[model samples]
Target chain A: LAKTTQPISMDSYEGQEVNITCSHNNIATNDYITWYQQFPSQGPRFIIQGYKTKVTNEVASLFIPADRKSSTLSLPRVSLSDTAVYYCLIGGATNKLIFGTGTLLAVQP
Target chain B: SQTIHQWPATLVQPVGSPLSLECTVEGTSNPNLYWYRQAAGRGLQLLFYSVGIGQISSEVPQNLSASRPQDRQFILSSKKLLLSDSGFYLCAWSLGRVEEKLFFGSGTQLSVL
Candidate 1:
């Protein structure tokens, strides 16, 4: 399983865009980058996933570089309710998906 | 549409007592099931996973054990609970593969005193 490193916490104001980057220097060729959002006392919710390039969904966008060593999760127009812990994972069917200490995004009014 | 049911929502048990947490999935069959533990202010730790009925894989060596008796039922149990077992337990299932996008339950808050 590839380990991921992310910022411990980030601060952003409402209506602003937030980007959380994750570093997975040991990412494998078959690995896919996936991001999840977790609120207090709840299970993490899948936000976006991408193998390479950019993939956009209604909730968030995932950007993966050509090297696949790093990925970014971009949240547009943040709101107070959007505050949560964000996790970036790199794995495939053969690997175990491990959740690291995620980036806690604080959306302040 | 599929849903996972896990209970009891919150449990307070004394150390040395037996523990059982049941999770059942509806609207799906033969889904891959997993049990994860999350300590306060920590990341999720995969405890066990099952690919099919009666086939379970333990991820970490601990006091907890898991069983898959039916196609959609996963159970987490411990003969004697330890204080270290106290944490938020989450049950999740995926469509076909273990690494696929997972659908998780509400989770059980376990407190071993």
Candidate 2:
């Protein structure tokens, strides 16, 4: 499993865009970057995934550079409901994905 | 179009007691099952995973054990609970081949005293 590093916490106001970056320097060639959101007392939910470059979904977008050393999870026009812990996992689909202490996104009113 | 279910949303058990928590997935076949433990302020720790029925892979030597009686049913059990076993337990299932996405059941909060 490719370990990841991310901010412990981030504060953002509603309606503003928020970007959380994760560093996985040891990412493998077949590994993919995936982001998950977890609200308090709930299971983490998938947000977006990308192998490289950019991948957008109805919920969020993932930006991965060619080097694949790091990736960013971009949430556009955030709201208070988006306040949660965001986890970035780097691994192949079959590999056991590990979760580190993720970035806690606090969306302020 | 899949739903994962976990039982006994919250559990309060005493030390040295036996524990059994069940997780089941619906709308999928031959999915991979996993049991994860999350301590407060800590990330998820993989406890066990099963690729098929009656097959389990333990991730660490711990006070907990897991079982898979069916492809979509995963169980976490402990012969004797310890105070350290108190934490949130989450059950998840992933489609084979592409494990990028996981469908997690609402976690079970276990408070062992």
Candidate 3:
């Protein structure tokens, strides 16, 4: 499992774009950068994933540079409902998943 | 579409009592099942995982034990609960390949008094 490092907390206003970056310096060649969002009292929800370069979904976008050591999760036009803890996981196609202390994004009104 | 189910949504148990939490998956076969515990104000810790029925791999060994009686059913149990065992338990299932995305259940909040 590739350990990830992210900010403990971040504050953003509604309607603004938010980007949370995660560092996984030991990322493997086959590892993929995946992000998950978790609201209080609810399970974590999958947001987006990328192996390299950029991958975009209707919900969010993931950017991975050539080094694969770090990645960014971008949420466009955020709202109060997007306030949650965001987790970044790096793993290969055959490894057990491990989650670390996620970045808590607080969307202010 | 694969879905995961876990119960009971919330549990309040006295110390020394036995504990059993169940998790099941639907719409997928031979999926990898995992049990994770998230302590209040903490990150998720992997407890156990199963690659197939009747096979379990323990990640953090403690008073807890896991069983997989069926391909889709995974159970987390304890002979006697401890105060430290109290936390939010989440059940998730993933495809055989890693990073393929995991589907999580609603999760159970256990409060040991």
**Predicted structure with the largest DockQ when compared to the true one:** 3
TM-score of chain A of each: 0.97, 0.96, 0.96
Report how far residue B8 has shifted in candidate 1, in Å.
Answer: 0.9
- Deviation in Å, model 3, residue B98 alpha carbon: 3.7
Kindly report which residue stretches of model 1 are placed more than 4 angstroms away from their true locations once superposed.
none
- Error (Å) of candidate 2 at residue A81 is 0.9
Model 3 lDDT tens row, A8-72: 99999999999999999988878888899999888899999999999999999999999999999
DockQ: the better of candidates 1 and 3: 3
lDDT of 3 by residue, B6-37 (tens): 99999999999999999989998998899999
Q: Write the per-residue lDDT of candidate 2 for residues B9-59, one digit (tens) a residue.
A: 999999999999999999989888889899888889889988899988898
In angstroms, the error of model 3 at B54 is 1.8
Tell me each candidate's i-RMS in Å: 2.2, 1.8, 1.5
After best superposition, candidate 2 residue B75: deviation in angstroms? 0.5
TM-score of each: 0.96, 0.96, 0.97
Which 10 residues in a row give candidate 2 chain B its minimum summed lDDT?
A: B94-103
Model 3 chain B scores worst on lDDT over the 10 consecutive residues at: B94-103
